[model samples]
Target chain A: MQLEIKNLTFAYNKKEGNIVDNFNLKVKKGEVVALVGASGSGKSTVLRLTAGLEIPDSGEISIAGQTVAGDHKFRAAEKREVGMVFQDYALFPHLSVEKNIVFGIDHLSKDKRKSRVKELLKLVNLEGFEKRYPHQLSGGQQQRIALARTLAPGPELLLLDEPFSNLDAELKDKIRRELNEIIKKVGVTTILVSHDREDAEFMQAREILMN
Target chain B: MQLLKTLKKASPGWFLLTAGIIILLLIPNLNIIINLFGEAGENWEHVRDYLLINYFQNSLILVLATGLLTAFLGAGLAWIIAAYNFPGRDFLSWGLILPLAIPPYIGAYVYQGMFSYTGPLQTFLRNNFQLQLSQQYFDFMNIRGAIFIYTIFLFPYVFLMTKAFLSRQSASLLESSRLLGKSDSTIFFKIILPLSRGAVVAGSSLVMMEVLNDYGVVKYFGISTFTTAIFKSWFGMGDLPTSVRLAVMAMLVIFVVLFIEKLLRGGRKYSYSTSNIRPVSRRKLEGGRKIMAQIFTYGVFFFGFLLPTAQLLYWSFLSRGGGLMETLHFAFTSFLTGGGAAVLILTGAVIIATTARMSSNFVSNLLARITILGYSIPGAVIAVGVLLFMLQLDGVLSFLQMGFGIEANVVLSSTLVMLIFAYAVRFMGIAFNSVNSGYEKIGESYFEASRTLGKGVTETFFKIDLPMLKPALMSGFLLVFIEIMKELPLTMILRPFNFDTLATKAFEYASDEMIYRAADLSLVLIFFSTAAIYLITHHRRRKK
Candidate 1:
């Protein structure tokens, strides 16, 4: 599915200048795009807009020829076949790794849901880690679980907002390459946001400078 | 199969917590809607109007007085500590939290005990100066007195919160403003005060709620607050409808205060842009300013700490020859009951907080908020709600047994169940706040890690999360326990018939102008409260 946006302008507060000015972008099917900018440049805002987590002031967001967002138009994140892994990885702290990964699989059939969870766990290399709590895992493991959870529903597109941001420097580079390989193997259309030029290079995606 | 797999994978503790919360939200609540919103049918308007006029006015006045006094004392002292270095500043930084230990009613007893006619302060005056009876002394057995005492203890809520805010004050902004020819006082007004308004409002709103909840002080002082009025209308006038009307009105007042607090916060979440938290540079006091700083800090401590303790000590000596053992016995018994209630409340708080975290559903979040609504309602209102809820339970049981010979009765209402329920309803927020703060520290990935390892939600909560939350659990329990020890109004109205806790014991003596007799128990209460505060602060320091 092709994702397209036209003339997006958004401001956090009207009194403040626009964080995401009259911006534009387009992405082809199954393409990976890396959004890069300094803090407050609205790199994350663009990711939120694509995931239907936010609405642009006066812009058209069309996915596969259906206008998802524009003036007085919208679709929710859950319904847009898009999944997000937050920077801090907003996992449900109360759920186990398996339950967290399978959280979005509520729409799947019972057999299918179990099968999908098993597959995603294996894909994230968390095969024997299902019973461990988030605190039990290292930062890298948590990132993978976050990725697994976000990808469990088999979203048409995956959005990772600085997924490696919280990891230590020694681990960030390794995890970035590992995550990129997994996403490519899964063949999910993805947008990876990063401030580190090295991260963008490792992801091997076309760059979309937010500012 | 999916349910089983999910259960197998979820932590058992989380599962149990979820089940427990679901049950709590469902079972107790089926009746709250009826109790709070049941049609009076005939007396609705009468109740509403009385609530509108008398109860509303009393609650509003008390809130306003308490809020202003607390803010003035709280913020005033906070500024003193933040801006100027003084001899007592270091001591007062932690010492100020001591007043929070003494329940308002207990503070009232000490205040009334020392200053009341024929008491130590007045008695000493009369004897030393040879004054005639009723010649030259002031009385604190009224609303104004309650306000004075409440401000002393409640101000710390404002003071500490504002101090934390002031600690994060932009030094560069103040420095730049000073360079631009603004005076220190001018900079304080334009920069410091405006920035700290949110903290001040939040802290004062809490003080207002505590004022509303207090029944012991107002009742002993013969003050006619909405809380006391509710009690009078319910037990005194034997009119539940009128009492409920008053309660509904009191609830409205609380609602407005809460709404205003929320509005003050707006959508702005305040935190320092950077965490390089250097303490505000202390200014050197000169001339009378140095004396003023010493005097102000000492004065606050004098009224807030020393005077009350002195009164309690003097009274203890007076009571030394009379029923001292009995007072000790009563104090021990009350401590046990308060501890029991604290444990129950903390457990419920942990359950609720954990459940809200797990589901992260809108409903759970709203329910958690609703439970905390009791924080704003006065203790008497909670007592009335508990009473009405129990009364209805008895009524329902009696109705069900008409055909048979069995009597369905209000077993929970008249026993420890009522006390526990009331305590939980009243102070569960303390547990929730403390535990939630710690719970937030445990990242979501930890839970996910456990889940993928084949643990269920319930198992993770107990095996993983609960262990990590040990400090929070202990601190939360300590806080709620101390609060329960100091709780007066709810204990007064809701304790099993004839039960005399330390709070009530002191109130009983203070009621008859026998401050010395009440002093022994008051001191014990103070001792526990001070220890609790010290423990909490010490734990917090260790954490830092």
Candidate 2:
């Protein structure tokens, strides 16, 4: 299994009921799955737990057969080797498109980082947009760059949180198609958290209705 | 062992550095508390029995009167400019903040010189209008005049803070009130005031603290407040212990006021349910109301900034002799000291602000709040504690007498390092707040993304946060530099022998009744300060 969860339960506050309760899932290597649910149905929470951004109340999460969380042992997000694309595409506002894409690839040699940035930008179909700041780019362009940045440094698993939510209906179909193609081309085990179940079928991923 | 392990994994170097800085920062306040019960100076009984109550009464009255007046004028002006689009509103919005560039003490002397029988107002009445006026009517050397001087010069603190608050307030709040058939004044008095309590309290507390810290205005006007008494016991009566005790008393009073305000606020937090908030858009005013709004802001600006600055400009040119080079010389010294202290203080601010923003630990948050308490401390009070620390260190270095024939505690008498250290202690809050607000605007998503991208706390700060936080760093440095330049009490108390900054130099010229000679230095301070304030506000408006 590329990713596994056994009996995940979590809550933002104890006074309120659990946001994710007794959740279980698994994904094979190179698999792409969509966790589909309405708002507040814990679809995003499940993704966050698998990414090691949040720990469960009681559960185990293993990535690549390594027990990253549970049994009083929890690895941090960076050590878990999981990449998250935030809902708002939290691009570093001060960094250029090239710097942001190569932000996580500092361990590479200078020439390697330069080529890798060029490769990722080309993959996202934004090969000539590396010099612009985040504010200068459109919402759709920003989402593409954010994906390139996340994928620059290879991760064992990729988590996308409502990546198409910020786009208008007119542009959503195109961006979602592009993002789905890139995820498959990279062949990383991926989980896409969204409210739309049809997007799962459209992207040829197994659908897990969270609620 | 578990707790230790958790902490060990959580940015230990940054945590330890923050802890060390906070402990070092608290020493001055702790020293004052410790010495409150220490050996009494020789004049302790005289101060305690005959002078302390009068000092308390005078200081209390000044704080309360000035606090209320400034809050009224400031919040009133802020509401008018923020909520309504009146004539001259755009220019008045930034123009009103210029008054802060005029130090209150300088305002004191300028007003006195203007009101004196031989001064401008009387001379103008006698010469231009051919009408003689009674001297008693124009007297601005009393406590009432002190309150006036302080309110006019310091109200911008309240204005800027409250205006920022009102500018971001969701428009739905006012729309709902308007739907209930409430008039604008009714909505303002009943809704806006309650919602703005936090900002108003924050701004007014600064005003009251400024009034408490003042020594120049009170001394020059012959008013016997707590600050004047601190100076008298130290320099006049040669009683250091009594002077320290008075400072501690002033510090206690300020903390008590802050405590009372917090208690009154209780736990009522005004939080928005949605992140997407539409800001309050201004309503247009026409006819008579438009005329009044224009008059109010411009009138305040005219008196608070224009009248005093123009008068000083005329006097400086009239009195110009061989002081141009001397003025530039002291200005350079002022810039260097202010710049050095600002750099040191902002560095500390960044450390603490980043730790507070990134972590949710109780101890770190408590430490950040304690650091802000330094702002409430009067400068004369900080001077006592800082001077005491410097003296102790001087004594430690005195053991160097083993090698040379130097005296034991002579180091405190001629060191700018001591003065700069005190400046850091007194002004850390200003820089901390600036950096903190900047962090609030950028939010934490970018930070979390950096962490997930395999960067540690320090690395992420250097590579990501620092570049984004450049504007905040610039404004914080400018504000701190300007404040250190205008500072009077601390400079007077802690400066090395024979050294003078623009503030002390201007004050000296005024003390000898040479108001004209003081003008050159005073205008030099105002010119730079006014330019900085304009730049800060201009940048803020552009960002908005």
Candidate 3:
């Protein structure tokens, strides 16, 4: 398994009780799974826990045989080879397209980083748009760039939190197909959260519904 | 396998540094509260019996009067400018803010000078108008005079806050009221006043804080406030313990009033952003109404900003005998101190605010809030606390001087360091608020985004957060610097022998009755303050 979680329970405040209670999941390499649920169903919380953006209360999270969280072991978010695309895209407004994509892969040489940016931008249908800022791009373009940036680092696991929520209905249908195609081409284990069951079906993802 | 345990931020370095800085800032302030229960000095009984009740009563009257008056004056102007449009309304909207540039102490000086028998007003009355008003009627050296000075200079705070609230108000509410055939006065009293109560209270509390924190106006006017009493105990009587005791009392009073204000506010923060908002349409005032509105605003602008400024410039040019070298040196000293202290303050603010943003724990959030404690209390209180703390520190490190055989005062002259420490204690909240607003705007998403991209906290701060926080940081630093530039009580007390910032220099001259000589430095202070006001307005307008 590329990623694993067991007995995950978490709460924002102790008095509020568990938001995600006794949750469990395992994903094999290159598999795509969707956690489908309504709002406050802890779909995003589970993804966040796997990405090391949050710590679970009584659970273990292992990434590629390394215990990244829980079980008296924790790796910082920076060290976790897990990438996430926030609902708002969370693009650094200050950085250009090229810089935002290259931000994750700082260890690579300049030429390699440039080529990677070119390859990813072309993959995301954003070729020759490297010099433009995030604000200059439309919503679809920004989401594509966010995907490109996350994929540029080539993480072992990818987490998407309501990635298609910000799009219009028309854009959502089109981008959903493109995003799934791109995720398949990259061939990385992916966990995406969406409230709509149709998104899971359209992406051909194995759906796990949560209340 | 190991037992599951709580996992927090990976690197504890920044969090620890933030905690350490907060504790360092707390030492002087907490020292005063700690001493409140300690054995009192010999003079405590006498001060408590003779002057304590008077000080408490006078301070209550002064803060309450200033708070109420400024609220009425400021909120009234805000309503007029926000709701009605008359000729010169455009300029007056921004012009009314100019009075804040003139410190209340400087305002006190100018008003007192204007009302004196030798001042221009009386002299003009006697020489040309053949009207010799009684001295008693014209005398402005009393508590009434202090209140007047506070009202003129401090009303801008309420004006700015209320105007901001009103300008962003929805047009629907007013339009609906108009559709219902309510009169203008009915809308103002029934709707606008009720809605603006929170902002007015917020603004007036700020006015009250200034009133409590003030040493300059009270000291010059010989009014008996907690600030003046602190100064007398510490400087006049050379009683540090009694001064600290008095400061603790003032702190308690401020805390209680602030508590009531917080409760009254009901934790409701007004953020009209996100939703589309149509600002209230301005009604055109005509005929008698227009003339009256114009007269009122112009009168405020004249007394509050123009009259004092023109006088200062006139006096500055008249008494230009202070040597160029001496003036330049003091100017150099003022800028250096202010700029240096501002830089230090902003650095601490950034660290504290950043850590607070990153951490989710309750303790870190509480510690972050504690940094603002200095700004809530008076400068005199902080100075007394810092002085006593420094004396204890000097005693602790007196071992460093055991072998030198040099004089204690000369060898241990850590005055500049103490001054900076005191400044960080006093103005940390101002800078923290500025930087924290920036943090709140951009939020932790960027921080988390950078971290997932393999950057550490420090690297992400420099690469991601710092770039985004530039405008906020620059304005915060500048505001803090300007504050330090005009600060009187702290600089006057804690400044080393022969050292003079712009504030202390002007104060020294004024104390010696060289009002004209004082004008040189006063004008200098006002010049910077005016520029700052312009920049702040420009920044806010651009942001809008």
TM-score of chain A of each: 0.95, 0.98, 0.98
Candidate 3 residue lDDT tens string, A1-211: 8988888888877798999999998889999999999999999889877877777777888999888988667787889988988888889999999999999997899999999999999899889999999999999999999989998889998889888888889889999999988988889899999999999999999999999
How far residue B521's Cα lies from its native spot in candidate 1, in Å, is 1.1
Which numbered prediction scores highest in TM-score against the true structure? 3
lDDT of 1 by residue, B1-544 (tens): 2222222223356557656644543333334435656556344576566544665666677788889878778887888888887677788888887778777877877766566675676787688997655623357776677788788888899998899888778676666787899987787778777778899998999899988878887887778778888777766767766666667667778888888888876854667778775667877678788898788888888888887787677667866648778777988887898888887777887877776665424545675676666676777777777776776676777777765777554356778787778777778777888888778877564554344333455666776688778889889988888888888878878888888888888888878877777777788888988898888878877877
Candidate 3 pairs with clashing backbones:
none
TM-score of each: 0.72, 0.93, 0.94
Between prediction 2 and prediction 3, the one with superior DockQ is: 3
Model 3 iRMS (Å) reads 3.2
Residue-wise C-alpha lDDT for candidate 2, range A3-113, written one tens digit per residue: 999998887666789999999999999999999999999998888778766666788899999999888887877787888899999999878999998889989999999
What fraction of the true interface does each of the listed models get right, in terms of native contacts kept? 0.00, 0.52, 0.56
**How big is the positional error of residue B447 in model 3, measured in Å on the Cα after superposition?**
1.1
lDDT of 2 by residue, B210-314 (tens): 999998899899999888888888878878889889988898789777886687566549988898889998999999988888888889999999999999998
Best by DockQ: 3
Higher-lDDT candidate of 1 and 2 = 2
Give lDDT: candidate 3, residue B183. 96
Weakest lDDT window of 10 consecutive positions for candidate 1 chain A: A71-80
What lDDT is obtained when candidate 2 is compared to the true structure? Answer: 0.87
